[model samples]
Target chain A: MPPISFALWLLVLVFDTGGQLAFKAASGVPGEGLGHWRAMAVRPWLWLGIAAFTCEFVTWLAFLSVVPLAEGVLLSCLNMAAVMLGGRWLFGERLTARRLLGVALITLGVVLVGAG
Target chain B: MNTRWRFYLVGFLLLMAIDTGAQLCFKLAATHAAPFAADPGWLLRVLREPWVYGAIAGYLGAFVTYMTLLKHAPVGPAFAASHLQVVSVMAASAWLFGERLAPLQLVGAALIVLGILVLARAEDEVAQTTPGHAR
Candidate 1:
């Protein structure tokens, strides 16, 4: 991949992972019904997530403009692994053996898609 | 299926449809505003496309549907079900946009889906084993 495309792809990954993590944090608060939505609305994490997604939306569009839609989408799957790691690091989520195996397989699959 | 199961099934299906539609719209918007530049002009070009709005609408719809579904659905299965859009988008791109994946890429896609399934099962197992665990 060219430098520009690689940059755009990286940006998309960063923003997507960040966005997902932020949303997770925002939603972790305990509530139900309209109160849940209202609570999240007042939180910075939710807004941050929305902002990151807005950035990701643009970056993803830019990335797709440079690569085939199919390839771009496949490559974007790496966000799953990235988010999982973020969860482990930030939220203290346990990375069990099975989860690790799953992450490894996903990483390998992404590599093949990126290289092929 | 029970009404509750039926609700989940419909919700997940709707999520997948919205996600797939969003991806296709993004692609269409990108194509319509081709020759991407890292500039305001390029951004403006993208904004001018109706498909971009379609993509935005899809995103909003998917978000609302996903949040609603997540309340009643298991996180593990819900996560995996949401991602099934990857497959749907791939098929749609091939059929509608004439995008062809290389043989290796096709294999890669399969592996990715399988990995997701494994992860989903792992999540369920972990949740079950860890008493008082909040996911």
Candidate 2:
């Protein structure tokens, strides 16, 4: 891929990571404070997440506009890697030895999948 | 390869990544934010955030990707590949949000990843055998 395309892919990755984080945050919050509708209208940050998701969808469409379905889907495997990295770095999530091992194996599997 | 398809693929991957990341953030935000105080009020409060908007955008992007993938690839493989989101999201949820998965769930995630990898390899083999131009 060209450098620019690579950058765009990176952008998509970042946005996706952001979106997932937002969902977790929303779901994790306790209690139904203002009901569903009221909460949606009042929270600006929530909208921010929604916007991120919108960007993600648009980017996906843009990707489909060019690449074949199979290739596009295959390339998306990289998202798992991105999440793993993001979870570790941004969230301070524990990478248990077992989980790390799983990640390593998964990485190898992804390589094979990409190469095959 | 056509530059457009290459761009699309990259864009799709980025969106997927952002989607996953945003979910994590939302979870974090939830931890800090007040618990749902009222049904509709809380729901509205959560939905109105810009982050939520971004996630909505990402979902749309994913929808487009899915449609295009279906258009270009066989449904079976496309569906299989799309399911990666499940693994990505769940694993992140467990680690970032402290959501514990049973040992069985962890094993299930591994199985899903393994199955997809195998399928991806099969697709690659088929692609290699085909005589069409890369683009």
Candidate 3:
């Protein structure tokens, strides 16, 4: 891979992982229905998530501009793993054997589609 | 089903719907502005396309639905579940665009569904053991 493509891929991964973790943090607020939405609206984490996602979109578009869409899709599958690790590290979410097996299987499935 | 499972089912379905809608909108936008070029005219055409706005709306709708689901659903499985759109988009393309579905892709789609079922069972187990756990 070229340097520019590699850089764009890295950017895509970072932005996507950051965006998701931020959203998870933001969504941890308490309440229900409209009240929950209102509470999250007043917080900064939600905006942070949105901003990261916007950046991710731009970076991802750039990545796909250089890389083939198939390879891009395959690479993007790593974001799921990245987010899962982030959830475990930052949020203390459980990562049982069953969950790991499930994620691994899904990642393989996506890889097959991308490679096919 | 209990209220918790009902919430998961409804929320995930809505998310998948929004995601499929967004992909379709983007496909329409691209088709409308075909023969891609690196020029102002092509950019202008994409900007002028109504489907582009629909795509943006779909993105917003998906974002809201995802965040709502994240309130209770774990990010890992929720994200995996979110990719169900891949299967939906493939099916849509097959039906609407007359695209051919490779056998490998079909196998892959099946694997993805199986993975989600396992993850769902994991979540159910966790929920049963710890009543107040969000996932």
Candidate 4:
């Protein structure tokens, strides 16, 4: 595998995590009585999140063109870890032992599946 | 950490379901034709099967729901759970496509559930503290 693939994979995580955070922040606000779908569409944060995720999909496609899907999926698991850290740093979300252990399990489990 | 976050977790679960459905349809479509890997007009051939279109629709559905979920769910756990997509797509492939999963993969699936249980417990604690929807 080319080192560039790994580098691109990390970039994929950055965009993905940013997308998630933006989406959450956008959604976290209380909505007016304007109705749910209409309300979400109107938020600038939601639009920003959408743009970030669109970037993620394009970068992901580029990554796939270079890397095998299986390998790409495996590497993409790191996005979970990145987001978890982001949660702590950005949102002050708790990282209790139970949650950390759970994350560890997911990471290992997904890698095993990718190995198939 | 609020009652609102419960709604977010529920939405996260829904997104996971959508994600799994997308993966399944994509796999079914791939076994039939890999339009992305092939030349032009591949869309017509690939789109012949409903699952091809289903795959795209499912992905879109997942994308929308995930953003909605981020609105209230605690960030770390919600993001962690989406990784369940990897485990789910694998399990779905084994069952639907008759693909063989190694014994280790089965173990992997079990581990995923265990992890989810741990995360769920933590979230439950948050849900309990929330006074009510208004609080």
lDDT value, candidate 2, whole model: 0.55
Task: Give the total clashing residue pairs for model 1.
Answer: 0
Local accuracy of candidate 3 as per-residue lDDT tens digits, B1-135: 988889888998898888888899999999999879989999899999999999999998998889889998888788877878887888898998898888899988888888888888888887877788865
**Ranking of candidates on lDDT, top first:** 3, 4, 1, 2
User: Model 3 lDDT vs. the true structure?
Assistant: 0.88
Docking class of 2: incorrect
DockQ of each: 0.34, 0.03, 0.72, 0.63
Per residue, candidate 2 scores C-alpha lDDT tens digits across B1-135 of: 655346435644654576686676566546444585758767777776556665566666664444344333433233334555556777787777677666655665676577555544554454455534211
Model 4 lDDT, residue A46, Cα: 74
Q: Kindly list the per-residue Cα lDDT of model 2 for residues A1-116, writing each as its tens digit.
A: 76655666666777776665554334333334346435544655456667887898888777766666546555766665566565456444434444444444554444433333
TM-score of 1: 0.70
Question: Cα RMSD (Å) per model?
Answer: 4.9, 19.5, 1.7, 3.4
- CA displacement after TM-score superposition, residue A40 of candidate 1 (Å): 0.5
Off by over 4 Å in 1: A1-14, A55-80, B1-14, B29-50, B65-84, B132-134
> Chain A TM-score of model 4 versus the true structure?
0.86
Off by over 4 Å in 2: A1-116, B1-15, B25-39, B128-130, B133-135
Deviation (Å) of A14 in candidate 3: 1.3
List each model's interface RMSD.
3.5, 14.7, 1.0, 2.1
Which residue ranges in model 4 land beyond 4 Å of their true spot? A1-3, A32-34, B1-13, B34-37, B127-135
- Every prediction: chain A TM-score: 0.83, 0.66, 0.95, 0.86
